[model samples]
Target: MGKNLREPLLKLLIEQKEGYISGEEISQRLICSRTAIWKHINELRSEGYQIEAKPKAGYRLVYRPDRVAPEELIPHLSTTSIGRAVRYQRSVPSTQSLAHEWAKEGAQEGSLYLTEEQTAGRGRMGRIWHSPTHSGIWMSLILRPPIPLNQSPQLTLLTSVAITRALRKQTNLPIQIKWPNDLLIHGKKVCGILTELRGEQDQVHYVVQGIGINVNATESVWPEELRPIATSLAIEGGRTFSRPELIGAICGELETLYDGYLSYGFTPIRILWEEYAGMLGQEVTARTGQGSVKGIAKGLAETGALLLETHTGVQTIFSSDIEW
Candidate 1:
C-alpha cells in the first residue's frame, strides 16, 4: 500500500470500531476511488486482519488480528515513533537480519521490524530461538546511540528494563529480569534480548535490538528441547493478550528509557533493573564459552556487565548463562 493510504485507512478502522462502515463512505473521506479503498482493505486483510464484508452493510471489523501493524498498533501506542514506522512480515528468517538490512540502507532510528515467526531466530551465544508462526512476538529495533563502544552493554540492560516494565503494566503477572538480558516469570524464560552493533574505532553506528516473547504458545507447542526451560505469556497470565498493546507498551517504554539513557547515562535505569533482577545477591553459576564460574551475583557494574563475586575476588562478566 502507498504511504498516503495508511492514515485514512487507520482512521476508518478506528471509526468503524463503533459500527460498520460503508465502502462508499470510506472512499469519500479518503478522497479516493472505491477501488482504491477495496485494495487497501485487501492489503489489511492480507496482513491477517479479520475485516468482514457484508452485502449491504459494507465492511465491519469483526476481529482485529493479533499481529502488530502500524494501523492497528499506533492508535494504542504511546511512543514518539520508536515503533512509529513498523514493518511486519508473516514469517521471516529473522527480524534481526531484516532490521540489519534496513539499518544498512539508512532506515531511521527507532524503525521496527516484526515477524510472526522466525525460521532461523537466534539468541545469545548463537543459540537457536524457536519462534513458531503466530505464537510469539519476534521483533527487532534499530537504534543509533552516541555512547562510547565500551558502554554498549548498558543499552541491552536498558532494553530489558523497558520490556520488563511494559509487561508489568500490560498484565498482572509477576515478571522479573534474569541478569543481563532475559525476561522470566515463575523462574522460567519468557523472553530474550539480543543486541548487535555496527561501528568503527570508538564510534557506534547502529544497534539492532532483537526481542522474542512467547505469547500464545502452549507447552506442547514448543519443541521438546525447549519445553523444560521455556514459557509463554498466556501460560503465566492465564489468558491471551493483544499483541498490539504489548508491542506498543514495549516501544513506548523503550523510547522513554532510551531518552533518559542518552541524557543522564545509565544510572537511573540500572537502579530500576536491579529491582526486578531475578538472582541478584544469590548464589548462581554462569556458563561461558571459555568456562564456568560459580559465584554470588553481586549486581551490575557501571557499564552494565554482570558483577560476579567469586571466592577469590570480584569478577566482571560480559556474557554468560545464569544457573540459579
Candidate 2:
C-alpha cells in the first residue's frame, strides 16, 4: 500500500523536469508519509532511475533508464489504443513471437509486446536483426483491423510511415523509408519492420507488426559485414535518444494514422509515404526469387507493391529486395 504511489510519484517528478519537488509537497500530493515517499524513491533508483534527493530541495529525476517497461512508457503515452497495454520482458527470443500467440488468443488490438533485448530477433525474409541489450527499441504491436486479407499488407506500409514521421520529428534526423519494411539513414539501415498476418481466405484475423529501431546504439554494435550498410540513430545523429519518448511518439503517431485509415482509406497514407519515400525515380535492381529485374525506381502501387519501370514495361513487384 505504501509503495503503490511510486509510479504516480515518478510521473510527478518527470513533470517537474529539471526542477525539484519538495518532499513535503510530494507527501501532500501522494497523501503518504515522507518516509514512504523516500522508500519508493529508492525503489525507483534501484530500477535505474536517477533521483536526486537533497536535504531541503526534495527529489528531482536526474535520469530515467532508456527502458520500455510499462511504468516507464504508459505515463507518457498519449495514445487511446496503441500502447495502452504493454507486456515487457528484460530479454526475449522475439517480441513478434509472443505477439502472434497473444493475437491468436484475441489480445487487444493495441496491445504491445516490448523487450530490452531480443536474442533471436528477426527482420523481413528471416534476416537477423541486431538487437543488443539497451541498444534500440524492440517491440511488436497487435492489430485486428476489419480489412480483407489481400489488403493486410497495407498495414506494413502504414506502420513504416508512422515510424518514419515519428523519428524524424523527434530526432530531427533525416530518416527515410525503404520500400516494404526498412528505414534508412544516409543509405544505411536503421530500422526494420516485419508484419505477419493470420486470417481466412478473404478475411484477416489479425496482424502483428514487429518494429525494431536502432536508437541509442553506437557503430560498435554492428558486425563487421553490416558496418557498411547498417547504422543507429546515435551514430548518425552524433548523440543518443531516449527510447521511452520515442516509443511514446510512435504509438501516438501510429494510433492517429491507424484511426484515420480505418475511417477513411489507404489513399491518404499512401501519399504521405511518398513524401518520405527514399530513392525514388532512381536505377535499382529488384532481386526476387524469380530473378533480378533491373529498372528505374518508380513509386508504390495502389496495393502497396513496388513499381519498377523496366526497359520492356513498368513492372509491379509484390515482394523483392531492391539493390541500389
Candidate 3:
C-alpha cells in the first residue's frame, strides 16, 4: 500500500515464475519490508491469482486469475489505443451507462469500461441482459468516429463481425453473426452488442459500444429461462478460458477493423459480416414495432441495412427482431 507496491511485487513474482522467491529476497529487490511484501502478495491473491507460500520456502507463482482488471488485461492487450485506457469495476449497473457518462465528459476514443458483474445489464429493445457475477464479459468501449450519424449504425454490424472473427481465431468454434449484433456458435447465442451514439444527425460526438459475452458460464449456471436460447464458450468447448486473454483479443480485433473502416469504408466490413451472416439467403420473419415482415434475408444495403426480399418487394430493415 505504501507508494503502490502491487505492480513491483507482481513483477518480482512473475520474474521468479514457478521458482520460489523468499520474502527477504522480494523485500530486498523491491526495497520494501517483508511485512509489506506479504501484504502485497495477499492483495494479488485477492485478485484471483493462485500463489503458494511455504513455511520456509517463501512464495511461488502458481497461476494467474481469469479476470479483466486493468492489471490483468493490460499485460495481454495488443491494441494501440482501444484498451489503453481502461476503467475496471467489480460490479456496476451497466458499463454502457458509465461509458455514456465518460463520453459526455470528453473521454478519449478507445477508452474502455469493464466490469465483472452487472446488476442491470441491458440489450436491444429494452431487453434485460442476464449478467451474473464473474461468469461473462460485461464491457463498453467508447469511440468518436469522424463519420456522419447515418454511418454510426454500421458500427453495430462492424462489431458483430469483429467479435465473431475474434472468437473464431481464439476458440475455433465456428462462430457466426446474427445480423444487427448477435454472435452465435452452433446456433446458440454467445454474444450481444449494442451501439449507442449521441450527436446531431450531421455530426457525431461519441459512440458507446457495449458488449456482453457469455464466456465461461456452465450450462447449469445459466438461468432456467435462457437455457434454450443461451450458451457459453465454456459450455460449448468443455473448458474454461482466460478472460483477460479473450478481452485483449477482442480489443485487438476491434482496433484493426475500426481502423480499416475509417480508411477504406464499411464495404470491407460488410463483406466480412456477410461471410458469417447465418441469416443471409434464409427465409425469416422479422418483427418491428410497426409490424412484421416475412421474407428471404438478402444481402446488406450499402448503408448496412438488412435487405429483405418480401412479397411486397425488397424491404429495408433498419431494426427488427428476426425469427427463422
List lDDT for all candidates, in order: 0.87, 0.90, 0.88
TM-score rank order: 1, 3, 2
Off by over 4 Å in 3: 1-5, 22-36, 53-58
lDDT: worst 10-residue window of model 3? 1-10
TM-score of each: 0.94, 0.91, 0.92
Report each candidate's C-alpha RMSD, comma-separated, in the order given: 1.8, 2.3, 2.2
Best-matching candidate per TM-score: 1
Give per-residue CA lDDT, model 3, range 1-324, as digits (tens): 573677677767778968998998888878888888877778788878989999888999899866778777766789889999888889999999999999888899999999999999999988999898889999999999999998888999988888888888888788888878889888899999988989898888899999999999877876798999999988888888888889889999999999999999999999998999988999988898899999999989989999999998999999889887
Hey, what RMSD does candidate 1 come out at? 1.8
Report the candidate with higher TM-score, 1 versus 3: 1
Instruction: Tell me which residue pairs clash in candidate 2.
Output: none
Clashing residue pairs in candidate 3, if any?
Answer: none
Please, what are the lDDT tens digits per residue for candidate 2 over residues 1-324? 564586688889999999999999988888898888888888888889999988878888999887778778877699888999778889999999999988888898999999999999998888888899999999999999998888987899999999999999999999998888899999999999999989998888889999999998877877889888989999998898889889999999999999999999899999999999887888988899999999987888888988899999999999888887
lDDT of 1 by residue, 1-324 (tens): 365796567668767775888888887877888888888788777766678888778888766667665666777778776987788877899999999999999998999998888999999889999998778888999999997788898998999999999999898778999987899998899999999999976889999999999988899878888888899999988899888889988988999999999999989988999998979989999998889999999888898988989998998888888888
Q: Which stretches of candidate 1 lie over 4 Å from their true place?
A: 1-7, 45-50, 54-57
